[model samples]
Target chain A: MAKQFKSLHPIKFYRDYLNQNVRPDGRLLSKFRPVIVNTGSIATADGSALVRIGKTTVICGIKAELAQPKAEKPKEGFLICNVDLPPLCSSKFRPGPPSDLAQVTTRFVADLILNSGCIHLRDLCILKEKLVWCLYADLICLDYDGCLIDACLLALLTALKTVKLPSVDYDVAIDKKVVNEDEKKSILIYNTPVSTTYAIFEDKIITDPTAEEEDLSSGLITIVVKEKELCSVHKPGGSPISEEKLYDCIQETIKRADLLNTLINTAISEQTH
Target chain B: MNVIDDNNLLMRKVNCKLDILSRPDGSVLLSQGDTVVIAGVYGPIEVKTQKMLINKASVETFYRPKSGTPGIGDRLYESIIQNICETSLVSALYPRSSIVVIIQEMQNYGGIISCAVNACCFALLNSGIDMKFLVASASCALDDKGVFHLDPDKLLSDKAKANFVFVFDNIAKRIIASHTSGSFNLAQYEEALELCKKACDAIFDFYKTKMKNEIANKV
Candidate 1:
């Protein structure tokens, strides 16, 4: 039937392209789409950035607010990363609550950020247990093609860089806290983490897979690399891949991290200037 | 060429595919100006006693974001879609039942809410559900310079002075639901309303072509 052909045609086309060591979009297996980043675009948020990877777009806004420190981590501040893949992003998600996909991605990015040691919690602490900066990094996907984690991480890092935290002083005279909006300080980021996603179609690995490619692929592997170190290698419940393939992905991710870091640095400098 | 003509963002074609999934009673994958959505409808099914309506079918809409679970902002979209569905459907015909619309987002450039509504409308029609009239939705945005645009892109939508999402019933061309954000004056609001209403004509035509193509494919 035509319906069967309709579904199978794309898979066959991808297979044909894979056989030639090329993609339908005319990119190599390790090539990534052109990435674009714009920082401090959202005036309302303390820090914000819009990041785009090919057709996929992610906007991240960081809202820093004062809050009581946790009883256990009294001396440490908190960073809550919430990644939103709204119905605006793609047809894969329904409109209502966060889907399982969103939660998984959020947890993955949160872990990546934490494991990368990009933002130190102790640096956010102010006045011991009395006051601390609660950084809320909200990453919203406006367009979804693929490589969402990569886009989200880039946006979060850029937005975090753009953040200007106001100086806070406790007024002993009136038992109040006076926030100095004029004196703003940016947070220190130790390392830059960039994620590279690959879709394993049979023996071939497709970099930055489109939504269609992802759906057709047998497995998915996401690698997060910071500097030259592998921060996280997330391959959850997919077709079996060889150890060599895994190592190759990591190497590709490392190379990609370097390229993306330059892009991020250039974007940050453009915004700062 | 002029700047307005070069920015053919609104002139892009819309693609719609129906009955893509087997599980749902009706399903549609709608793509407009890079904004893609998949809508599924399961209706006239049994409803839980606690959530059932005695006189009319209970309408439940579940909107799934691409990444995270639904939050407060999603609730607003759900409510808007719920209102539009409630007004369009003759729910009394299927008492003590439930009609669930599940919409999935793919790519969003702009005019998301309007696109979602349109997808839901098509899915409902595909489901062969009884309706008082067909519904079409369009969005209009007033940029910082006070220029009016139909189905504005992300950049314009982000910096626009005001934006409006309007749903219209096919019968009397009356407004079924209107959702607006940001700020605008009375004249601007009226201008946006008139512009959106005009934009709906093209949207309705797009729907007709989609429906015809879907029917032809089935045959």
Candidate 2:
């Protein structure tokens, strides 16, 4: 009976649930779904992770290749983040070049990766201008439930944590790189930024929405938190939110970041064992 | 021939996961040694006017490289994969529609073309699309010592004199597609083809085992 009403009058159903301070998925208004992280799942990728938040599943694979450093930044390497929302991930996405949503998400994630200072590009440099590691981190959405940004960020961070690069020595005389397969080292990660997404349904704020809730909501806010500092607050052209509500979101994200940090560390440690 | 050993004939570790993505009709993440490719199949759906075929479904393929936009070499890979898929798929069964195959290159240690082709086949199988016959591909590298290395890594391939990729059908195991680079004599070419044919059989067996496991899980 509830399912029929949810399908017929989705907004009304959500309003009824919101009136009782609960969500359709039985989560409280501010409660996030359980997050599951698995690292080093793809052997081919230098670093890889599969993350699940509720029903949304995302896989991130980081492949490190040798490339010449850019002219301007001769000492730093490149970190490219791309998010793919294929037709297999959601019915709304079609088979073709990446959609607008995908492009935006890629840019947003790239910005967070660069601006957060989580990964030092200089650490990726091997031979200054001659050769450096170009990390291609590709995040593919396997299932689109909701809280996509949250899942993508977690997958990227965990995958980055698991990356191991084979030591490469440059022979100056021959101008060639000799990779030592026996010696491998992990990249230095400075910070682990976790993102939390919230949806504004009418006047009430709901956390970690599903696909159905995302559609019916009037606005969406994604907050990226690193430790106690706020890294980014992305509210893309939705209904205006109050300052206090936004502050509450950031505070909530700070707490969530601590929990996610522990989760990511445990996942990585489990893989090592 | 003198340098070729029995162990060299064995292909690298091949791993695959089917139906990994929920939205696509069929999807597979396949890894051949260190070269990994993810492929998704969507077919018998609405077709654009320009790409639609009256008698058969049009097959389209897009190959996305790891980092940058698809360049000339990437376009060449796309056409090669599209032709192979068109030949293997029974497109005539779904007329006035289209079958789209999208392959994303996740990692490339060596033999990426063969890995991508095999990944596409696995994705098609997972989608349960009608096909004339299943296809599997194998790659080998010819070194300066006149020896063939099956599933060469980046180190071997970079120092190789020539590289070869061959696709074969499961029914007759006949050649479906062949791509080669560098120069070699006719005898060397024949020898390389023979080497790849045997490797492709192992891929076919892998596919069968994967399908059997998938069925058992469902039951």
True contacts kept of 1: 0.00
Each model's lDDT: 0.80, 0.85
Candidate 2 has an lDDT of 0.85
Q: Tens digits of per-residue lDDT for model 1 on A1-273?
A: 545764669778778778888887888877788889998989999999999999999999999999889999889899999988888889887799787567767876776777677889999988787889999999999999988888899999999988999999975457698899999999999888788898879877788998778888855777777777656555543344554566677677777788889988899899879
Report the Cα interface RMSD of each model, rounded to 1 decimal.
Answer: 22.3, 24.8
- lDDT of candidate model 1 versus the reference: 0.80
User: Which sections of candidate 2 miss by over 4 Å?
Assistant: B1-219
**TM value for model 1:** 0.55
lDDT by residue (B19-72, candidate 2, tens digit) is 889988999999988899999999878999988889899998899999999764
* Model 2: interface root-mean-square deviation in Å: 24.8
